[model samples]
Target: MFGPDKCRSTDKVHFILQHKNPKTGKFVDHHLKFAPSVPYDKLSHVYTAILKPGNELQILVDGEEKRKANFLSADYFEPAFIPPKTIPDPDDKKAEDWDERDKISDSDAVKPDDWDEDAPMEIEDAEACEAAPGCGEWKRPMKRNPEYKGKWHSPLIDNPNYKGIWKTQEIDNPDYFELDKPDFEPITAIGIEIWTMQDGILFDNILIASDEKMFAASASSDVLSDCQKKVFDVLYKVADIPFLEAYKNQIIGVIEKAEKQPILTIGVLVSIVVVVATAILRLLFGRKKPQVSCNVGETDAPGNSEENEKNDASAPHPRRSRRET
Candidate 1:
């Protein structure tokens, strides 16, 4: 499945290999049937195929191997389809008179008087009935049929003749033969055959290796990171003009407001600073407001004049009354 309609194979990937069987003189298809479906999108993707010693082949997506199999075993045998271990014995057959169903409907059952087989399931509200005052109250109550027997079926039981999973004996494929080890051949290059509607698709980081460690080291290199950074830098520069303009307008608005009320702006800033400082002081040193203790008869505590001066300094200053000119 490639596209939304799946009518085209442009996005579809099918890994195929055509091998001429020397014994049979016919070309054999030793291909992977369940290749991972490629997604058609703007995001980049990586598909990799690794052929290692011992005829092991691995398919990777985005540097992670998703499928693996032994090509030797797969090509020489039917890897996709497996013979059933147990099959129903053809010699054992159900008799013509045998009834598999255990239950049947009771022929003597009769319909109840209140069944109301012809009654309507829902009726109009009595208030909405124009001709009759209580006309719409006549509705049939939906209920289960009294004489209905739920779907009849035979109860399951262990079979004496199960003869658990019968498997066909493995036989040598007369036409199958092994290719020379060197004939497997080293992969000198990788190729992509794409019939796409769009062009300019850049495929990068093509790696071919029999050793897993070598492939891992190459795939994990910083080349991709550097390329991604370069691409995103250009993209951000192209897309940032509107955002920068909007931010500039916001800063200008703030400056204009500050110009209109310089004193108010200063007061608000000072108040914010004071609040933040007070919170920090409380958090860091556990400072708290001092509770003033004054006796009922005493106007002021002894040696408290300096404390009163400090309180006066901390409180907001009252504006002095102006003298007449």
Candidate 2:
């Protein structure tokens, strides 16, 4: 099981075992026959039968790829210990195990048609995914709160401003409405910053159960697993790492200097100058605009049409038109 691959050959195979006679200083050959279906488990002492040129050989396991196999030579392999017979589980339980904690009907299985905010349901907040240093495989229940467990990882912490995480679940309140599922315990007091695909997690808000958390922590140790930590350091930062790590502290200073040296550095200065100049102009011209006012008795003057009528009566036109009565 330790080996990545297994091999099986059906043919009647023979292995040539060799030994040297100490008195004559000459080689001796011993032949060993391998039978089909004789598992590697049956082999008593695989290490004693070392194979060398013109000295020894062995029949390999049947039905295996010969990609890494060496027919001409064999390395000495030893077994640690033989295992006892496999035992079946007492519960006779498989992955399909189902239990009836509460009486409910399977006739019309109900699924949440859509997430309704008004119902006061699971409000997933914080993003589920952040830079999880070493998050592994993920799976969910086919039914709500199915029996399952596996390793998982939470996203790395980013903000120093925030305190430790808070965990919440819907509580068992008589006022809360239960779903169609049996003993459908509604989640109570969900983490105010919930985590779910509904909100499309872009943050590290997923908090696993204690048992699930233990699985992840046990699968790895220290800061990060060997495979997980390699990602941060293995990348090629030729200009920095190979020669500059020695003066890592100085590198930050160099970066700050470069950041400030942008040709666009004068943009802020220019913007400030413009704003100050405009403010000064507004202040200087504030009092110059005309201030209009009207006397207390003043009313709108008569229209020009009335003035035309008065002029018409006073000065007659040169036409023989009848005057107004």
Candidate 3:
């Protein structure tokens, strides 16, 4: 179904924050956000009986999916760490021979043959996947990175800890992390409550690590803040209410909160219009109301009746008389 705001779920989805490399201009790490969304597909199974209705439009975001990143604000700028194009790590073996003549699609490039649920991926196993006839034949798979520029990715990501083919530019953290003295100051991370657990901590699992690290909730059940705690509480009571009663005033509040984007956009637009109208009115009428003397002969102000009358009488109308304004 294509609506005007038809962005692929993967494309539109982004982390609440992404750490950047000050020197190069790249995001070093990213983490997801869990702000509530309009309630859609909510399924609850009670013991053997499943509760909660089954369908509505829903957005699914898979962390594994790939998409280009967009920087949201120009106010904040971070340099990206661009990996060196040439000089990949030198492996001990003859750089894993390449055939030099083939064109394989990206889908075929890194896929392992023995990727079945139970298949072994051990390099020493006899059943381990043999390189595709065209694998590395057309394009030799690149070597691991010699310097830890950031996270070690498969063929696409360079390895920083590699001791071969490259030298370390710096030892500890990269330089320029502080573009200025003020930029270097530490920022207290908000929403850290997302990382806590009932048992002091749910678990510490590093899902993505670069200069910065991204973590999953100690447990999916881990409530990191008052909000998440409320969500979890709602999950518990969702089934207790009758199907129709499930949507109480509390439900309306939650739904409205989720849909605040549209409401906020409207509010801002209205405020801008009001401000513009007020500015226009000020421009037309100055600020203090225009002064007018009602006396027919009054000379002080235009639009003053006294001024008008005075002018009229002097001009032979005899109706001009000065009166206190």
Candidate 1 to truth, TM: 0.38
Arranged by lDDT with the best first, the candidates are 1, 3, 2
Tell me the tens digit of each residue's lDDT in model 3 across 79-105: 222322344334324333333323323
Top TM-score hit: 1
- What lDDT would each prediction earn against the true structure? 0.49, 0.32, 0.33
Instruction: Report the lDDT tens digits of candidate 2 across residue range 1-325.
Output: 0111123433322333234333344444533322223233311111111222342232323222222223322232111011112333344432333332333334344434453324432333344544545557633213322222222223343343333332332333322222221111233443333323332122222222424334344322212234432422332232255433544454344333322332222343344345445555666775664332333553545687687566655764433233322
Greater-TM-score candidate between 2 and 3: 3
Stretches of candidate 3 off by over 4 Å are 1-13, 16-40, 43-80, 83-325
- Maximum-lDDT candidate: 1
lDDT per residue, candidate 1, 172-260, as tens digits? Answer: 45554556531343446666655456644555556655567776665544123444446444434533454344344443444333333
List the candidate 1 regions with Cα displacement exceeding 4 Å.
1-13, 43-45, 73-192, 203-223, 226-239, 242-325
Q: What are the per-model numbers of colliding residue pairs?
A: 4, 18, 26
How far residue 51's Cα lies from its native spot in candidate 2, in Å, is 44
